[model samples]
Target: MSSSSVVAFTLGASFASIASAVVFFLRARRQVQKVRGSPDQVVEVQPPHPTWTAGQKQPNPFGHSRTVSFRSTDVVGGSCYPLVISAYIPRPIALVSTISKNGVVNMAPFSYSGAMSHDPPIIAFSVCRKPGGMKKDTLDNIEENGEMVIHIMSEWFVNAANLTCSNFPPEQDEMKTAGLTPIPSVSVLPPRCEESAVQMECKLHSKQDIKNAAGKVTATLILAEVVMWHIHEDVYDDNSGQGPTTVKHDNLHVISRLGGNTYGTTTYVYDLPRPDRPKTGRKV
Candidate 1:
C-alpha cells in the first residue's frame, strides 16, 4: 500500500480500538451497579473451596485473557499509584497522630503502613509528599520529635479517620475537627486515639527517602518501634494463658483501605490451615 493509505489505515484502527474500550468500560460499570447491594444488606461468607482435596482444580482456570504489563519508567506517578494500590488489595491503615514542636496536634490516615518485625515490634509506613513537593505534617512532626502514636482504625470511626487526611494547616488540630478524642500516650508525646481499639505508642526508629528515577525525593519511609500498646478491653483476648494476648477480630472491626476511596471490612472470612510436607521425603 501507499504511505498515505497506510497512515489512513492505522488511524482508523486506532480509533476503532479506542471506541471498543470505551464501550466495554461503560458496560462493566453498568454491571457493577446492578450487582451492588444495599447498605443494610448482610454479606454472606462463601468458602472458596468448600470440600476440595490437596490437588483439586479450581473453577475457571483460564477465564482471564493474556495479562498486560506496564513499565514504571514509562508512566507518571499519578498513573502508576492507582494501579499499584488496587493490585495490592486490602491494605491496613495507620491512623498516625503526631504533635508539632509548638504542641500542635496532627492526625492522618496512611494505607502504606504495616508491621515488619515482632521481636523488636517495628511498624513501617511511607508518607508521600503533598502536591508541589511539599512535605507532609506527619513526616515533619515525627522527624522533629521522633515520636508518634499509630492507631488501627475501626469501622465506627473510619469516616473520622478519613477526615484527618484533609490538607489542613499544621496549626490546626485534626483530632478535634474529626470529632475523635485523644488521650495522653504513656511512652510518646503524641496522644492516642480513644476511639481506636488498638493503639501503639511508637518512636522513630529510622527513616529512608524514596527517590524517583530523576533522583527527586518523592516519599519518606518511617520505621517506628512500638514502645507501648494500649488495647481496649473489649477486643483483647487473653486465651494465650501466659504468652502475648491476641485481639478479637470480631470485636475490633478493623477497617482496611482498598483502591480509590473505598474501605473494606472483615465481614467475610475463612480459615485455611497450613499443610506440612510428608516427613518421609523431607531433606536432611
Candidate 2:
C-alpha cells in the first residue's frame, strides 16, 4: 500500500514487540529471585574440572625417619628411603636437550614440563636441586644465559636421555656420550637435539627459590615463556604424506621415575577427558 499507511503499521508492530520484551524481562527477574538459594531447588552448573590436578598434597611414605634430627645431611644423602611422593607423580613426556652458557653445555630431561598459562604461552617446571642437592648445569645455563631449549623424548632418543641423568663434570658434553646429535637452537645459546622428535626454545620470565622443610633452598621452580617450537615432520600429520607414518606409545618407550631407583614406562595406557565438577560446592 500507501507509504504513510505502511509506516503506521510498522510503528504499531514495534510497540507490540517492545511491550512483549518488557514483560519477558520482568518475568525473568521475578523467577531469578524465586530460585535465588531456594533450599528445595538446586541449580545444576557443570564447572570446570582439573585435568592434571588441583594442587597435590601427598605424604611422603619414603621420607626421613621420625628421628626428628631435622638435618638430612646428618643422616644420609641416599635419601630416607621411599618417598610417598612417587604415588602422586604423573607420567611425564620427558624433554632431553643440550643447553649452554658461555660455551658450557648441559643436557638434562625435565619431567615437570606443564602448561601453566596459555595466553602468553607459559610453561613451568620444578628444577630439583642436584643430588647432595646442588644447582644443576641446566638451571645455571637458564639462569646465566636466560635461555633454554627443551626437546621431546621418544623411543629413538630415550636411551640418550637415560644416559644424561648421570652426574658428570661440566666440561664433558653429555649429548655426545648419550648418543644424541647437537642441533642449533632457534632462540637460545644451547643447541637442540636433532635426534629429538620435538623441541621448544624458551626464555626465562621468572624463577623462585624452593626451600625444604628445613628452610634450605634446595630447588627452584622455573616459569618460562616459549619463544619458539620446532616440531619434527615425522611426529605430526602435515597432510602432505611426507612424514613418519605411525608412532606407537610403546614405540616411544618413555622412561619414568618410580619409587626409589625404579623406572617405569607405558606398559598400558587409557585416555578419557576429565569430568566436570562444581567449583563452588562444598562436596559434603
Candidate 3:
C-alpha cells in the first residue's frame, strides 16, 4: 500500500477505538446507576474528615458564630437563674393547691416542677422566696399540713391557672379569684381544680432548703409521693390493651412555660422514627 493510505488507515482505526470505549463507559455507568436507585432519591453521604477528628475544632454546620462561655457565679443573677430558666426551652406548669392550718385554701402555679420517679410515684417542685425574703404561702401550707394536690394546666383553663400565680394574701382564696372550681380530693386535704384534666394527690416525702452565699434560705425544694392519679377519660387512650393508658396530646392541649412571659402549646406535633444501627458492629 501507499504510505499516505497507510497513515489514513491507522488514524481511522484509532478514532473508532476511542468511540467504542466512550460508549462502553456510558453504558456501564447507566447499569450502576440503575442498581443503586434513582439519582434524585439518593442522599449524599458525608464521612468524617480531619476537621472533625479529636482536638481539631470543626466549623459550625449551622453557620453560628463562635460561642462565648461564662461561669455561673460570674453572671449577675447566677448561672442557673438565666441559663436554666430561659435556656431550658419548655417546662411544664404545676398548679398546686394547699390548705393552711386554719383551713384557708391557697392555690398557685409553679413551673419548676417535674416527676422524679415512677416506682414510688414521686414528684418535685421548687418554690422561691416571696418578696422581703418571706416564705411563699404554698410552701408554708405544705409544711404545715404535709399534703398538697398538683393539677396539670391545659389550654382550656390556662388563663385561670395563670391568675392563681398572683401575689394574693393568705386570707384570699385564689381559686375563687381565678374563677376555678375546687373539688374535694380523695386522699388529700388540699382540693383539686375541676378545670384541670389531670390531677395528682401528693404527700410530702422530703424537703430541702436552698441557701445563697450569705447562708440565707433562698428557695425550698419539695418532693412528694403521688398517692392517686385522676385522669380525664377524654385524654386517656387504651391502645387496644397493648400498652398503658396513653394520654392523647392533641386532646389534652397541654400548655408549657417558656422564657419570660412566653408560653408554648402542643398544637403542632410530628413523629420521626429512630434509625436502625448497621449490622457491621459499629455504633450508629
The whole-model lDDT of each prediction reads 0.82, 0.64, 0.78
State the lDDT of candidate 2 residue by residue for 130-149, as single tens digits. 76778888787777778877
User: Candidate 3 residues 126-199, lDDT tens each?
Assistant: 99998668999999999998999998898878888999999998999899899999899999999989999889
- How well is each residue in 1-284 modelled by candidate 1, as lDDT tens digits? 99999999977766654555555556545544544663322233433444557763332232222244323445654437877799798899999999999999999999998999887999999999987789999999998999999999998888888999999999999999999998999888999999999999999999999988777888999999999999899899876575457788877778899999899876544445456765333222
Task: For residue 218, give model 3's deviation from the true position in Å.
Answer: 0.6
The Cα RMSD of model 2 versus the native structure comes to 20.5
Return the TM-score for each candidate structure: 0.76, 0.59, 0.71
Off by over 4 Å in 2: 1-81, 96-98, 131-133, 238-255, 267-284
Distance from true location, Cα of 199 in model 1, Å = 0.2
lDDT of 3: 0.78
Total residue pair clashes for candidate 3:
0
Once model 3 is optimally superposed onto the true structure by TM-score, how far is the C-alpha of residue 185 displaced, in angstroms?
Answer: 0.5
Best by lDDT: 1
Candidates sorted on TM-score, descending: 1, 3, 2
**TM-score of candidate 1 on Cα atoms, chains taken together:** 0.76
Candidate 3 off by > 4 Å:
1-62, 65-83, 272-284
| 2 against 3, candidate with superior lDDT | 3
